[model samples]
Target: MHALVVDSDAAESSFLSAELQRHGFDAQECVTGAEALEIHDKFDLLLLDLRLPDIDGLEVCRAVRATSDIPLIAFAAGDHGLDRVLCLQAGADDCLAKPYGLRELIARIEAVLRRSGPARTAPRPATDPLARGSLCIDPLTREVRLNGRLVHLTRKEFDLLHRLAADPHTVHSRARLMTDLWGYPAGYVPDARASRTIDTHVSALRAKLGAPDWVLTVRGVGFRFGRA
Candidate 1:
C-alpha cells in the first residue's frame, strides 16, 4: 500500500520514507501540512509529525479527517503527553513517541492496518452479538453488553456506539458522525450544539458501556474506538 510521511525534518523524512519503501510499499514525503492536505486523498495511510512549518499536525489531521478515513500515525520528538493526546484527539489512529525504533514504527503501521481492516459482510443472526474483549454489541437488538450484562443507552448513544463498534481503531470525525446520525438536514454549520450533542451521546454511551476511555477524543477532530 502507498503511504505518505509528513515531516519538516529533511533527514528524518528521507529516512522514514526510504525505510517504508524498502519494505515494498510506495512512500512519499511532504515537508508541510499544507502540502499534505493538497494531496491527502492519494495515500492509504499517513505518518505525520506533530510539529510542522506551516501548521500544527493536529490541524492537518483534523482537516484531512473532514472527508477522509485514512489511517493516521502521529510522531513526536519527545514525551509530550498533552501533545500526543491532542494528536489522538485530532483523529490520528495512533501516536509514536520520538526516539522510537524503525522496526517498532513498521510494526505499529501493520498493527493499525490489521486492526482497522474492514469486517466481512456476514448475515448476522436476529440477536447476533459481537464481542471484542470486554465489550459486546448486539446489532439486531440494539443492546449493548459490557462484561456480560445489558447496559442502557439512548438512541443517539446506541447509534454512536454502533458506528464506532463497526470498525475498531478507525478514526471518525464529529462532522462525519453528525451527518451519519442526524443527517445535518441542510445548510447547517457545525456549532457548539452539534459538538455537545455528540459528546453527550458519547458520554452516556461510555458510562453504560463501562469503558469510559473506549471512545477516545481526538482533540479538534472527533472520536474513535480503540486505543491510540
Candidate 2:
C-alpha cells in the first residue's frame, strides 16, 4: 500500500515514513499542506499532522475529503478529545494523539484501511433493502420503516441501526460503535461521553421504532439488533 505522510517536522516525518515502509507501505513524504494536496491522489492513504507550514491540516483534510474518500488518519498534538473530534468532523477516517505508540498507530492504520477497503465477503446489494421481521432499511434511499410505518431518524441514528441490523448476531462494543460512527478511535473519547452518546441514540431509535426490544443492550458490552 502507498501512504502519503504530511508533516512539517523533518525528524517526525522521517520516522513515520520509515516505520510505514517497514510495515510494507510505500511511504511518500511531503512537508507542506499544499504539497499534500497536490499529490494526494498518488497514495492509497494519508497520514496528516495538524501543524503545517502553508495551510492547517484540518483545511487539508477538508480539501481532500471534498474531492475523494481516501483513507485518512490525523496525528496531532493537542487535547485528545477536541482534536480527535475536529479531525473527524473535518473528514479524517481516524485521529491519533501525538506521542502515540508506533504499534497503536499501525493498528489504527490497518483498521481504517480495512474499513475503507472492499469487503472480503460479498455484501448485500446496495439497491436491496435490509429487513429483519418488522424492521426494514433501504440503504440506497436511507429510509427505515418499522411495522410498515415510516420511521424518522437522524443520519447517525440510521447509520447506527443499520450497522446493528447488518450483523444481528454480533455484539458491538461501544468503542467499536464510536469508531465506526464518529470516526474517533476507540478510547479517544472518554468512556462516559461515548457511552452516553450511544445510549442516547439507541433510546431515540427505540422510541421511534416503538419497540424497545428491537435493539437489545448487551449490558456493559454494547448493542445488537434483537430477533423479533
Candidate 3:
C-alpha cells in the first residue's frame, strides 16, 4: 500500500512518512496542497495536514472529494474540534490531532481502509526475480546471483541492495536508508557515525559483488540502484 503525507513542516512530514514506511506502507511526502491535489490519485490513502502554505486544506478536501473517493485522514495542529468536524463534513474518513501515537494512527488508518473496502490488504510482492544486468535478486529465496553464481551477502547488505534495486534509480534518503536498514523509529535522527552504517554496507556489497556500479552514491541524498 502507498500513502501520501501532505504537511508543510519538512521534519513532521518526513517523520510521519518514514513511520508509515516502517509500518509496511510506501509513503511519499508532499509539502503543498497543490502538489497533494495533483498527485494524490496515485496513492491508496492520504494523510492531509489542515494547514498548508499554498491552498486551504478544506478546499483541497473538497477538490479531492469532487473527483475521487480515496481514503483521507485529516491532521489538525491541535485538538481543534471544529476543524475535525469540517474535515469529516468535507469528505475526510477520519480526523486526527498532531503528536499522535503510531498505534493510534495505524488503527485509524486500518479502520478507514476497512470502511473503504477493496484495498483491505496490502498487495503482495512480485514472484519473479529482479534481474539487472548480470545481477539477479530473489526475494523469496533471499538470494543474490551474479553472473550465474551465487554471491554471499550479509542480511543487511542483501536487504539494502534489494531495497534500492526494487525501484531502480529512485533515490532513497540516508535517513530513510538508516531507518530501513536498522530499526530506527520515526524522528530519530542518526548520528554521524550511525549514518555511516549504510556507507559501510554499500562498500562491502561492492567488494563482494565486484560491481561498484550496481549502487550509485547520491552525495548528500542517499543511494540508488544504478542501471548496471
Candidate 4:
C-alpha cells in the first residue's frame, strides 16, 4: 500500500512516515500543497494536513476531488470546526485532529483502506444485464464492474445502481426510486426527503465509479441510466 503525507512540519511528517513504513506502507512525504498536488495520482491514499504553506487544505481537497476520488483524511494541529466540515463537504473521506495517537491514526488509515480496498477477482456474469457502457452490475453478488474491473460500492449505493441498471434507458423519477428502494410511499410523507437521499447515493456512486456522466439527470424529471 502507498500513502502520501502532506505535513509542513518536518518532525511531524517524519514521525508519520516512519510509523507508516513500520506498518508496511510505502509512504511519501510532501511539505507543500503544490508538491502534494503534483504527486497526487501516484499515491493510493492521502494524509493531508489542513494547513499548508501555499494554501489551505480545503482548497487542496477541492482540487484533488476535481480529478480523482482517492481516499483522503485531513489531519490538523488546530481546532477549526468550519474547516473540518468544509473538508468533508469538499471531498475528504475522513478527518483527524492533531495531537492524535499514532495507534489511532493507524487504525483509521487501516479502516479507510479496507473500505476502499479492491473487490475479489471478477466473477462469472449473471443472466440479467445491469450495466452502462463498459460497466456491469450483478445483483446476486451485489457488485458492479467496469470493463471487468470491480468498483466497490456500499450497500445503499449498490441498491441504487441495481435499480437503475435493472432497467437501462428507463428513466425513474426520484420519487419512484425513493418509494421503491427505501420502501417509503411517496405521498405518505410531505417532506419526501428520501428522494434527496437518492441524489446523494447517485453522486457517491458516480464518484466511486469515477464517472458522473453515466447517470443522466433528466431536467424536471428523474435520472436515466445509460452511457452517454
Candidate 5:
C-alpha cells in the first residue's frame, strides 16, 4: 500500500513515514497542505495532520474528498469533540488524536485499507429490470410497471415486491421480511401488531398489481412471489 504523510512537523512526518515503510508500505512525506493537495491522488492512503501553516486541514480533506475516495486517517485535536466530528464530516475516513500509539495507528491504517477495497473504487454494475410476464420491476430506478402501465407504489410496497420477486422460488419469513425491509434489529420477535403491518402492505401491493397471487402468503410462515 502507498501512504502519504502530511504534517508541519518535519520530524513527525519522517518518523511516521519511516514506520509505515517498515510495516510494508510505500510511504512518502510532505510538510504543507499544498504539497499534499498537489500529489495526494498518486497515493492510495493519506495520513494528514489537521494543523498546517498554509491551509486549513479541513479544507484539504474536503478538497481531496471531492475528487477521490482515497483512504484517509486525519490526526486531529483529540480533546476537542467538534474537531474530530468536523474532520469526519469533511470526509476523512477516520480520525485519530495525537499522542497515539504507533501500533494502534498501524492497525487503524490497515483496517481502513481493507474497507476501501477495489470494489468500492469501481463503478457500480448496471442492474437489469426484473421482468415477469406483464410486470416489470427496475431495481436500479425503483420503478414498477404492470401490463405496460406505470404502477405507483409506496416505498415499502415496492421493496416488498422486489425482495420476494428477487427470489421467487424461496419463501421469505415474516420476521426475516420485517428485519430486511423495515430495518428491525436482528433477533427481533415481531408481535401481532408488527406482523399486521407487513400483511397490510402486502395486501395493498397485491391490490396495486391487480393480482393477489403476486405475493402469496405461505400460511403460518410469511410470503413469497408467485409467477402466476
Candidate 6:
C-alpha cells in the first residue's frame, strides 16, 4: 500500500515515513495540506497531521472526503475526546494522538484500509433478508428495517450489526469483532480503544433501531445479538 504522510515537522514526517516503509507501504511525505490534496489520489491512505503549513488538516480531510472515501488517519497533539470526535466528524476514518506508538499507528492504518479495501468493494452476496424479532436486514440491498420502518445506518454500523446478527447465539469478543470489523489484530489495538469503538457503534445501532435490547452486551466479555 502507498501512504501520503502530510506533516510540516521534518523529524516527525521522516519518522512516520520510515515506519510506514518498514510496514511495506510506499510512503510519500508532504509538508502542506495543499500538497496532500493535490497528490492524494496517488496513494491508498493518508496520514494527516492536524497542523499543516497551508491548510488545516481537518479542511484537507473534508476536501478529500468530499470526492473520495479513501482511508484517512489524522494525527494531532491533543488526545482529548473532542479532538478525536472533531477529526472523525471531519471525515477521518481514525485519529491518533501525538507520541503514539508505531505499532498502534500501523494497526490503525491497516484497520482503516481493510474497511475501504477491495475486499469490501465487491458486490454483496444476494441473501434473503435476516429477521430477528422486529429487526430485519437485507444483505443484498444493504438495508435495515426496524418494525417494518427503514432505519438508516452508516456502512460500519450496518457491518457490525450484521456480523452479530448472523450468529445471534454467539457472543463475539471485542478483540474478535475488532479483527472482523476493522481488521485490527487482537494485540495490535489497545483494549480500551477497541472496546470504545465497538461500544460506540453498538450504541449508535441500538439508537437507530430503537430497540435497545436488540444487541445485548455481555458485560465484561463482549456483545451478542438477541435478548439477554
Each candidate structure's TM-score, on Cα atoms with residue i matched to residue i, is 0.55, 0.55, 0.52, 0.61, 0.54, 0.55
Error of 6 at 209 (Å): 1.0
* Candidate 1: residue 118 lDDT (0-100): 30
Q: Compose the digit string of candidate 5's lDDT tens values, residues 45-87.
A: 9999999999999999988875555788999866688898888
Off by over 4 Å in 2: 123-228
Q: Give candidate 6's whole-model lDDT.
A: 0.79
- Candidate 4 C-alpha error for residue 47, in Å: 0.3
Deviation (Å) of 115 in candidate 1: 2.3
Tens digits of per-residue lDDT for model 6, 22-109: 8898999999988898999877888899998789788998888655556889997867888888888777889988879888888877
* Candidate with best TM-score: 4
Worst 10 residues of 5 by lDDT: 117-126
The predicted structure with the larger TM-score, 5 or 6, is: 6
Candidates sorted on lDDT, descending: 2, 5, 3, 6, 1, 4
- Candidate 6: misplaced stretches above 4 Å? 1-70, 75-111, 115-126, 186-190
Query: What lDDT does each candidate get?
Result: 0.76, 0.82, 0.80, 0.75, 0.82, 0.79
TM-score of 2: 0.55
Model 4 pairs whose backbones collide: none
Q: How many backbone clashes does candidate 2 have?
A: 0
The digit string of per-residue lDDT tens for model 4 on 1-228 reads 889999999998998899999999999999999998898878889999988999888889888866555678998666767767777777676788777888898898877665453323322234575656788887777778989998887655776677677666789876666555554444434143344445667787788888888777887778877573
lDDT of 2 by residue, 1-228 (tens): 999999999999999999999999999899999999999977899999999989988999988875555789998795579888888878787898888999999999988877664344424435678989978999899899878888877666887888888888999888777766756644554366456657767887888888788899998778888873
Q: Count the backbone clashes (under 3 Å) in each candidate.
A: 5, 0, 0, 0, 0, 0
- Per residue, candidate 3 scores C-alpha lDDT tens digits across 15-127 of 89888988899999989999999999888999999999999999998788655557889988788899888887776778998778889999999887764542213234466
**Tens-place lDDT digits, model 1, residues 4-99:** 999999999999989999998799999998999999788888999888999988889888755455778999779879888787777777899998
* Prediction 4 global C-alpha lDDT: 0.75
